[model samples]
Target: MATEELNAIEIEIARNRLSSIAEEVGSALIRTAYSPNIKDRRDCSAGLYAPDGTLISQAEHIPLHLGLMPTMIANAIAEYGAENIREGDVLMTNNPYIGGSHLPDVCVISPLFYDGELIALVATMAHHVDVGGIAPGSMATHATEIFQEGIRIPTMRLFAAGQIQSEVLALLMMNIRTAEKTRGDLIAQVSANRLGLRRIHELVDDWGVDGFHRACDSLLSYSERRTRAAITKLPDGTGTFTDYLEHNGLYAAEIPITATVTVAGDQVTVDLSETADQVDGAVNCSYAVARSCAAYVLKVLADPTLPSNAGLTRPIEVITRPGSLVHAEFPAPVAHGNTQTSQRVVDTIFGAFNEFTEHLVPAASSGSMSIVTIGGIDPKNGTYYSYVETYGGGQGANPDGPGASATHTHMSNTKNTPCEVIEREYPLRVERYEIVRNSGGSGLYRGGEGLRRSLTLTRGKATVVAGTSRVATRPWGLNGGGDGGPARVEARTNGEVRELESMGSLQVGVDGTVTIQTAGGGGYGEPEAGR
Candidate 1:
């Protein structure tokens, strides 16, 4: 099959088939995982790639992971040498400097072969519950360097020639607290990739190798053409906006993040050179994470329905200064940046677009993921347990209608762990879970509301870490609308209550309770006179 012979129908069919394979692998991972983080919250992603490491298709999972996985796989291949890669070889890495978001987000890559030739690659990334650090969850708020975060695995082989490396597996399990759960999740990731490999081989068998290659090329070309056309629709101009983070995990001083978006004839460029330098805390991000945030904003402003392949990002360029907050250098703590700083990057980029795009974008939402991690010994079973979950907030209101309440938005696409799962798996209880009324900004079209959740320790001691933002600054509104409320965290132990900072940690005894109240979204327009 020649390039000219591949029709639109063939391209569409190939696109759907590839996307289905990615989604299937993701579902397999979620079902087979053991930890509540992966099994209950679904904090994982899967994707299919070309032999040369170009992203072809991905499940509609985590925006941050989906964008960064390609870079991690490409870097792994480069470091290990593509020629040295053999069939049944599964590569693994979680080094942020080498295109990973953090240490806990372990990535595994495997090559798919047909007729003794490399045809494609299948990859999956899962966030383990514990990876050995100052804290059990590997997301410490006070860590000043990468060594305190977790075990850093460079590009290496976890599986060779279809054989698991027991030595390597044993070394990894020895460093983490929750060895059993982590081992289970790691096996689940491997199984998910194996499934993807089989599905890809079947696709090749049906379409033939030549036909499959042609279809993939056609799909990439189609996405590139559509993206360029979408850029042409937006007026050629430049927009700039700057936002702030409440703290850098170690200080109360605000850190600034600025984005400048420039739209030309058929391309867009996002510049973060004006952003502040990386701090000595865990609020910095890798360059790949920065690029993902920029790409996500472009997709939201342009046609979002466009297939999320390498071609979709071909028309966009991201510029960042080395050693900056958005592009941290080696050894800088970055566990919190993957979730917390990523949200601010999206907000700053969208705010820049709204500056000159005729107000096409919506107002700001609760700019935080509100991560909570608890680690302790289960008294009933005398086993270690690490519980990690991210709480959702409000969605920004648009010109068309009001925003939705109590939902995850931008950079995070994970579900909350069910109360029953929490009670069944750990020594904790969900005492209170409800929406915070009047938290949304008042306007003609009101913003979305936030929520409050409280958890109590059942019968053991534990270490708890709470991370969030927008506690000092409100979510900005558009077109004279009101700003939204801020976030709050508190802890109560032995009849004494104490407030916690935006990024804080504490040791809790039995019967202690930790409460989290997320922020709300901004309104769309000015409010009417008192009704």
Candidate 2:
């Protein structure tokens, strides 16, 4: 049947069925994974794609991961020809230059076949705790180049012909610190893809291969039409804004990220060609990351409920200069770029929209993920343990109401690692976990409050690394609202308590405590007259 002949009901049913499969695969990964980062924090994402690499459906997981997964899959197929891909073959890679967010975010791709013909593809991307880098969690703040970050895996066959490649797996295990945990996470990703394959096969069985293809084509066309209509609703104009990264790990100077948004007719263009050049620090990101941030911002302003697929990006164009902060070239470190720099990109894009677009853009939130990584030997078991967690902050207030408090915002969509799980899994103790009251800005509608979390080492010493932002720069409020509070990090030793930089590492002795206070969201409007 022709795609044009498919009715709205049939298309809607296919969309829901495919989306459910993606969500189910994500749940399977979270339930079966061994690491707390995946099982508890849920730092993984799942997606289904067409044979030509167009994204069909994605789990409502991390925005950063979802936006970049399609590019990664396309790159993989380009390098390793689709003709070379066969049933039971799984491809994997984490090379930032080859369409990846960071070295630690490993992606596994599996091609599904129906009756000896390539029908669909299923993939998953997860942030492994450690991938053999200068820092324990593979997110080295002071790293100068990608080589120092971690093991860079290009597109290769992790599983070929329904068999596990032992030598290939061994090579990866030899480079990282926690081999067993990494192995478990990798297997979990593979298992999730297998589940996706089975579900897709079942779908093909119900609707013949040709009918399934037609439904997918119809869905794509519907989403594209919706996106274009949304774009046409915005007033045609161009607006530009610039935001800064507080620190670039090696230096304390702010790095600028600029976004120029132009909405014309039924399309939008985001130009980042004038942004700062890539720095020596780990604050630089790849083109894929830049594209993802721009795509995310457009979706928020245009239509948040639009189906997340390749069609949604058809009306958006993101342009970045080579070697710029947003589009880093080869060898530049990008560990912090995926977390810290991505937030700045989102802020700049939204700030630009606020300048001209009639859409009510919210004030800036905490503007940071506040990632903390601690790696050490567990005194109880004498084994190496790597703890990775990203803290939540206040959400920016919008026209509708006040921003939500102590929540993950923007590019990152993840849950905090529970205190009990943290204490039980690693050699750490939670000393304080509470909201920093009054940290949010005051306006007619107040911004959300930030949180303060402190952790103490239980037994042995460990290397603690903190990567955050909004330290020197406050989250700017919209219209007449007040700016939000700034983020702060402190380390306490036996008798001395010293403040730490936004992006740096420190050695914590036994009983030492590291406290992180995230920034609050910006207020929505001017405060009411006070007595």
Best by lDDT: 2
Which runs in model 1 stand beyond 4 Å of their true positions?
529-531
Please give the TM-score that candidate 2 achieves against the real structure. 0.98
Per-residue alpha-carbon lDDT of model 1 for 379-447, expressed as tens digits?
888888999999999878877777778889889999999999999988999999998888887777888
- Candidate 2 yields a Cα-based lDDT of 0.90
RMSD of each: 1.2, 1.2
Q: Which portions of model 2 show Cα errors greater than 4 Å?
A: none
Worst 10-residue stretch by lDDT in candidate 2? 1-10
Candidate lDDT scores, in order, read: 0.90, 0.90
Q: What are the clashing pairs of model 1?
A: none
Per residue, candidate 2 scores C-alpha lDDT tens digits across 67-100 of: 9888888988889999999899999999888779
TM-score of each: 0.98, 0.98
